[model samples]
Target: MPLRSIQSAIYTTTMNHSLLFTRFTVSLILCFIASAAVAAVAADKPNILIVFTDDQGYADLACYGNEANKTPRLDQLAAEGTRFTSFYSQTVCGPSRSALLTGRQPLRSKGWGMPASEITFAELIRNAGYQTACIGKWDVSNRKAILDRMPNAQGFDYYFGTLGANDGGRVRFHENNEPAGATDDMGSLTTLYTDKAIEYLNEKRDPEKPFVLYLAHTMMHTIIDASDRFRGKSAGGLYGDVVEEFDHETGRLLDVVDDLGLSENTLVIYTSDNGPWNQPKYTDRKKGHPEGSIFWGQSGPLRNGKGSCYEGGYRLPCIVRWPGKVPAGRVSDALFATIDFMPTFAHLAGFDVPRDRRIDGIDQTDLLLGKRDTGREHFYFNNAGVRQGDWKYLKPDAYFHGYAIEADRKKVDELYNLKSDLGEQTNLAAEHPEKVAELKALMRQIEGNDPPGTSPIQIK
Candidate 1:
């Protein structure tokens, strides 16, 4: 038959109409399959477990640079993950924790340190239909107002741990509002919190939706009841014992996740709230950070220890581990502050953090995933130390660093090459007058909302 004649015949009958209908059905089926595949890829969100430590130093973990301390678990985590070299925190507990949870500077929050207006990281994670829980210290407020400023009030489905009122009255462990279990008065509270976290991981985790577990351990913070497993078993003395104990707990969490087949799908971040607090204590107590009069944490060449805005106090270790996604056994010197956690996590979970308020943190997801080289250019630090990038432009002066060391330095201004001199020993203001002025200008721009010279407490 001729081609045109055959075509005409094929289109003429009821059978031809049925054949066309079958063709259309197959095309629709293929389209549906393609869409389903795309959806599956889009829905594979990773579970986030941010392990925030209190008063941990830049050289606290074996993975980062601690020579005397033993952190086997953390070392292994780094071996299997990327370690952040230029990670920074707010330099103190309450304020730094606030920034991580809220994605904004503590100065903007208005309640002194952590304040109240900000939302928790758990809350943001919860909003995305993920299971959210904060299982550790809730030091946003004092003892009385703890529940009001609780992890639940902030965004967690559940809140465990303590409502610490500084180092003296810091609570040990609580499951929800009640005490987790009554341990001996001098018992190590860090282990209790860790145990609670593990319990939550085993029991509360729902497979249908991903979970956000904020394991804010008060490990090195205090009530220095060393874990039974690590007591007197490290090279760095008592401080090493505390760090090692915390590392053991970390190992347990990671092992639990791996054993349950959740390791590949989970993203774990290990960081500290601030630098170690080295309060002068002439004696070792039966419990807590109070036991050690002097802080044993090594600043690793950074000037001034915790409670001040020097590199020792503000800049600390940051380690991230995500199987197959984050680079394994790698180091990135990208500068990232604790405040970037919310934006980074939100971006990973396929959403944007709200731009309703000015956020100091940039989405550091690229830095975390080893995709970006340089971290955020400018970050504000003001938990006893206020600095903007290379210029050591203190909020008004540089005595703040001296204040933490309990010495009264003259109200002399300072400028240093942070890249070349991380210790901040040499004063560059006299030599590089132009650079000092440039950094001061940069500080004004980066500060955005913080007011300068508000506090009147001088070191001298």
Candidate 2:
């Protein structure tokens, strides 16, 4: 046992300790990566952002193949989430908003057709502890006398923008109902909605609570108003420039989410209330620059334009992005209605449907998660209409000049195999008489035909 032996023993011990420490550190790193992957996989809850536009078409988005229109931000959003091919909103403003709120068809609620009855997504989400905010257009039950049935009564903590359609329609705004100075000599309504929303995020957000922002855009469906910044920006027309401006403002919201570190946990939804305004004719006041386009905003082989009971009136463009969940850049052809929004939002927020409350929307949470197929195979449309898979059934007399005309004479009346005749040009009622009877029976059954206030349908 000499000094050299002692030195050799001491060196071997130190080297062994170093090797052991290295292995432990590597193992810890691997565990951290595995944990992160699991968290990504299991992160189901999301901050909901329902981005609703005024009168965009079912086929108006670049992602939806509206080659004429360019929506780079929305396109990028689509690339990161799910795009629904056959989403729906009402042909007009109020009813679509109503159906989305109550989870029931507009016809079923008091403000069913207009706005002033009861219930809303804001109320429900707020009950579930979400910070609910409605931007752009309220368009329904916002009047002071209608408090019991208004957005605040229904559950929104923050509200902004016009309470109705165009500022020309029923001008109003609220910073949580406290009106602020217009940001620009006229900022676009789109910019104001986004700016106020960002301010809410900056000042009121707790970082721990999930938020539900209902952005009801007043652009592209207005007095065709635009800020000085975007007065003339696109090739489509002034309306096209306005739409481009709308798209740019959307980019700002996206940036805010990224900057605020909310992107990963937020579910941003983009859609329109319905398709274009019946391509309004141009007069001086009607300058008609923003009346949407039959020339540019295509319904992609769908029958008819807005205001008609055809696909254009109700069918809409829908895109959803939840960073860590939902398949990215995928298109979904799932049949969803305005009525379904409430239930979907509730489920995403982890709230339960009240048993006493007659919730009409089926909880398609599995569909939203991309765990199920898109062909929902079931849904009821506005104006006593019904669509089950490829066969869309109108009540033979279900025309709605405004939105809910009880007796529509030139109604398509029969059913069309949507897969074979999506344009709905043919009448299959005679050949498939049995199918007609079946669908007609369902329409009456689901509607329950209070049969007192409106149209009557006692078949022969």
Candidate 3:
């Protein structure tokens, strides 16, 4: 053909190519915008930060009536959130951690014997598209470095700190299933754990995904100590010093949350694993401590301390802060426990609690959100006793591991109306046999056909 005909063909082909390129570019930009919107929606889920302390007592903070230990930061936290007056954990550390993680009683979770099969809140929340991290003591693996039962296998994306408690005045650290190092300087843990948590919030976590940071501090457990700046700084002795240091470090963590503009969307929970080791039996354990250190924590009006089936052993100080969600400065006397967390998180994070096994935790989202004041009509204490409404009943042979009371003295079923007798000084079992029988029946019902390898104190 002619030169004019060839030029026309070339122009038409070139124009068609340009149109295709423009359409492809527009499609790419639209895809990018859609991905960004999805990320924003995921980030809208609330962040959960749980600061769990070891062996802290019911009255360790000034907000809880501690006269010697100064805890202005925690006092302010209580003032800024809802303080739970009838909160409870387990009688000891391992059981408490297991209960908190599995939302089951020690009888079902198996405490130190918690198997790899047990599911944790971390697993469920992480599966629901949240970043999960566990920092500090993890006593659920029976203190062993069991790979299947460790944090990584149990659903945490990042794991730092010890697999167990700082028992023996030392702890060995692990970062994501690998050994990091060991430390005997017990005083360094509070600050160190807080630093790790801050690092996670600032650098490690994914910005586009909501996160769960379970910072379980190991301070105030057995063989407690305080750093140089905190030592001898309080009137309540070394234990008091540790408590004050914890308060300051927690304040620092909260400040970082504020600095990152996460205050409104981050749900902060501060609670203890169990009550302090304040019994007379712990006297020998404090032999090497500084003179007049008063290593044990005060139980306030509670009758006994850790390892007893009494108020002090189970009751704990719990404060929750989620601005504009949980009512500020409200003090609630509703009965709740660490075992309730799994189901509550399921409600908040949009996940399902495990249905194959028995879960002892009642969903407490209503209580936390201030929609309801009543929580847990009945809470069983291991297999030894049970509390219903205001009445708590203990069998004649309820196990007491920490104290040295004679067996003969406990020959009769004891009962107390905790509403009026917080100290448990009055025994109302003889006057209220009907209530005793009712609670005993509830305890037996909770005991249920126990699976093998459970606690030996099954209700008869």
Candidate 4:
């Protein structure tokens, strides 16, 4: 039997082993290349930046109909993208932010901040591999127990802003769950928030990942202030001065995006939580408000201002700019809401909307992309106890702001045709009872038989 046969077998075995090792190495290299390509594609996904203003009225922006307060940058934003005529948010900040984040009605979520059970847009986008940040006034909750209820816990990777309103001189600014400091001077707030947002984009953001930056501003609301640079800048007085500075800061933020060559790939959205805060003092005030006098923001032709269930309260001023994606200089009458943003962003990021919970927001991706002209046939006004379209029906003795209906009007429903009567001067309830019934049915369906009620009369 022989040494020759054993040597041949050993040589064949060694050759086979070498061939298998070479194949395995080649396979590993191909897998690494494929994984890198996938990451690159994910990084190139469009960036979403929502610049939400505080208590800005529907007609506050110059392009929105204000000729007194100059908003060149915001006007330019409208010129560069589609301006929505019928965008909505809740009547107040807390509910509005919750609705925007979770795609559910604020009442549907937990008491104040977003419920732990709900899935946030941040979490969804992050799951799809995007960086998330909330960099402004976050009024979702006043509670401090649950860190998970905060932005850091909800979904945002970074949180740097005030927990609640900037009024009362007791506002505490927090950064990622820790108290950063007390925000004494409200005048420089817009600039500070903008700087932080830019820092996140330039320094904190990962170059290999797409990001969502929610820049919620703290301006135009009550107890307002403006930096010295913007103090005497507008003809509309103190209110006008604050608005102008907000516009300037917005322009600065946009400039950063363009300088970074990310304009085309970034989606910039500018809007407000609700309408203007027009109280007793602000009604008779002129453009140049006197010293020590409070100035409530204007709502142009809309009836009433913030905290009321009227059009001026919930119908927010909205501007969306996405360079080539959204058509420039296009004005749309599409009905949209802040709640819609969660689903819309998820759609754009190629992520699935959470199916485990009830999401009130409808997908408005087609409307934003200019593939459609209309969206959301019916929009429920949470504060109003009414549903709007062409016809708006107010429940019997529905209380708006602090004014209740007189005895004669208490038993009767109030109806207004928003299309023909934007100011809501006429009550066509008796004339259009059928339309009243239709809207009432819708109100009950959406709000679950909750009779028309007020929200403790928020002044300013």
Candidate 5:
């Protein structure tokens, strides 16, 4: 044990310690860089805000060819984005919401019978690191506020609205899973829902994380009313009043997005659940309202209205705006539907669609971004019939929700060239048996052994 040997051992130990410290410092720097990179990628993900309205007609807004209703905000939205001419939802409310959420046809999603087992787009997008909130009418829980099928259970981080429609001229509210009381002031819904949504965007959501805000308004449906300020102010009557108020409220929400500087990176989709209740058979029932008879929405030139298997029953007005990303002032006639949102969100949000269940939605990211002109080549009308290209074939005895005329109840297949007859006025099933057979076969192939009529659900 010489002094020289002990000193050398001490020096070697110190050198080894210094080398380990240097390596640890370098590893810390690399880890910090990796974490920063991950955060940057997450921040770059775009926000998705879907504003869904109930029972809005295809030509409800000025941009959609309405001459009476003044929807300046929504018209500006259409001017700033692509207005889809051939967009669709479902023939009714519950089924349409079900299709949008699950991306499956109502027959498979079971519409009002949608089980807790069904996976929703919110579930998928939330899993992909997006903060999700639903701040309005959520009718998919069979309008009963079934806990497991409600928004909170369906993967929304925050839920603040009715679990059902305001069908009885009243709606009960829920915040997350807890009851938040009820309100019968149907007129206040549009602004109230918009306020909640703006609050979520400003206060509830994590600014660092991308988000999905689904604001489903409960206006323009049956038992419709408008705020005192808007009541009786439109040439389109009470329905127009409701629509104009909706437009203004929607503008407020969009303004919040702009103020927050999320516009360029946020994809905003405005659409409806179904066509308006324009049929006299349905409107006549609302004749005894205290504030005069509640008028129905106009279906433009389209035939029939909600609950029928005709163009007006399913077609809707859709405006998609993503500044600089989606072309402005573009009017697209390509076919699209609420069912397509699930898969498209999956693609844009970077999540895989559920592999176990059948999803009927096609990824229309290309169509949305102006990369493609055409959309889905074929769309099925539940079990009623199918539409391919310009030809739509309705099977004999096509199901209608108690609004079909005796003349339309004929026991023969009806076919129409939608290109020439957007109203579906011309029946060509006799002359073009080939097109009818082709679409019929397509329906049979897509629907399998499912029954022709929707599974009966009790409507309030």
Candidate 6:
């Protein structure tokens, strides 16, 4: 009860409290370190970024042998990744997007508007705990009732971009199903999408979770629009300007990934939905309509562009960059398609492919990693024909050359060895009638296997 006893009790209490606080602080630091380590380990699973451009041709970039449109960033991307010499996508926007998202031919899935019943790559990756985002042109379907068929309902955690192409005065834009704005000014669309993507990498995405960012650019399609910063920047006219702007925005996105230290772990792929819309059909070009020539994109040495079943229509330019995993500056003439991305990504991310439905995509993990050279052996191009090995058989009236050919003109089955005839100029169908029959039989087999509800295989 004396002063000395009271002081001794206070000292004891203070020392006890100090020891307890010190212990708590040390435990907190340890827990923080352990959490950081766990996140780092999870990051090893790698993130995915798909830079898909609409209507971009195989020869659109510098690395693809284009002399005019100088896409330094994309050229560098090709240099840092594996560039595919022969890649395929659907002949149109909606089908191509559907194929990439679902890993099944549009016919195999439910055609244009990706059916709600089909699974998507985003859904597959999401099941593995990854953050999935789709930013830019999502032209799967823009119809009101099928609006849910857009990226958000399909599986994207966040969706920002247009529902269709930016070819008209007004492009429908949305931010996760809700309307963002309908803008006639297409100049800023690329910047908006790219900035949003960078923001996702920098802020929106959970740092501990791997992410799938599909940035589908709207430029390089019809009525090409470029930002003011890229006007008159190249020798290829307005089309060049638009492509260069896309390249710049792509560089900005890559820079952000590097800044965030995600470059090493991110699998970045740059490709197109289909070949360029070089010859847009105009039954009558009245006053204000967009001139196809002003925004024409080249398909290089290939015979015809867009809308055609020829080499130019669906043969795409694909670049895959994964730092040490994918070989740098490697050019592969292997056969791969947009439909293969779902299974390939699922394979790389250690996820399971949807077992309930039939997926047409084959895993190309080994092919992309440079362990092998070939990917796909047979690819069916909508109405074109079946391309197995080097043989391609065209249907009697399958080739649709946009505005170049008369719609009612009659044609015959044509076959070509793609390995020797990349341009498809020399038709050997008459010479090798047996080969043509084989391709026709394969086409018939594929059609017979088509899931119910698919439109009858349209050969004409």
TM-scores for every candidate against the unseen true structure: 0.82, 0.80, 0.93, 0.87, 0.90, 0.88
Would you list the C-alpha lDDT of every candidate in the order shown?
Answer: 0.70, 0.68, 0.87, 0.80, 0.86, 0.81
lDDT of 2 by residue, 1-460 (tens): 9999999999999999999999999999999988776455335557888888887667666777766567899889889999888887777677777777777666675433444445676766677667777776666663332555545666787666655565343355555555643432233577877888788788876565677888888766746656777766666665666677778888898899899888888888888877775443322234333444222245777775566677877888888888767789788888876677676776777676544546567666777778887544566665556787778887766755653232324545667788888787787877888888888876776677543322222111
**Separate clash counts for every candidate:** 6, 7, 0, 0, 0, 0
Worst 10 residues of 4 by lDDT: 451-460
Per-residue lDDT tens digits for candidate 5, residues 204-282, read: 9887688999999888788888899988898878888888999999999999999998898999999999888877776
Name the better of 4 and 6 by lDDT. Answer: 6
Quote the positional error of residue 63 for candidate 6 in Å.
1.0
Query: Which portions of model 3 show Cα errors greater than 4 Å?
Result: 1-33, 285-292, 403-409, 450-460
Tens digit of lDDT per residue, candidate 1, span 129-208?
Answer: 68888887777765444565766777888887776633563455556666665444433666766787788888887766
Q: Tell me model 1's lDDT, rounded to 2 decimals.
A: 0.70
| lDDT accuracy of residue 169 in candidate 1 | 32
Candidate 1 displacement at residue 356 in angstroms: 2.3
Best by TM-score: 3
The 10-residue segment of model 2 with minimum total lDDT is: 451-460
**Backbone clash tally for model 4?**
0
Evaluated at residue 452, the lDDT of candidate 6 is 41
Candidate 3 least-lDDT 10 residues: 451-460
Give the higher-TM-score candidate: 2 or 4: 4
- Which lDDT tens digits does candidate 4 get at residues 1-460? 5899989999999989989998998999998988798767765578999999998888888998988989999999999999999888877778888888887777676435566766789988998889999998877666453676788888899999887885564467889989898767878899999999999989999877888999998887666889999887788888889999999999999999999877988998999998877756444443433365455777888887777777888888889999888889999988888988887887789888776666678778789889988777777776455655577888765545442122233546879888999887898989988988888877767766233222111111
Residue 338, model 1, lDDT = 83
Name the 10 consecutive residues with the lowest summed lDDT in model 1: 451-460
Q: Per-residue lDDT tens digits of candidate 3, residues 1-460?
A: 8999999999999999999999999999999998898677665568999999988989999999999999999999998899999998998888999999998889888888789999999999998889999999998888999999999999999999998877677789999999999999988999999999999999998887889999999988877889999998988888999999999999999999999998999899999998888866566556545566677887899977788788888899999999999999999999889988988888888898886777788788889989998888888898569988799998988877745243335567989999999988889999999999988888997888655333223111
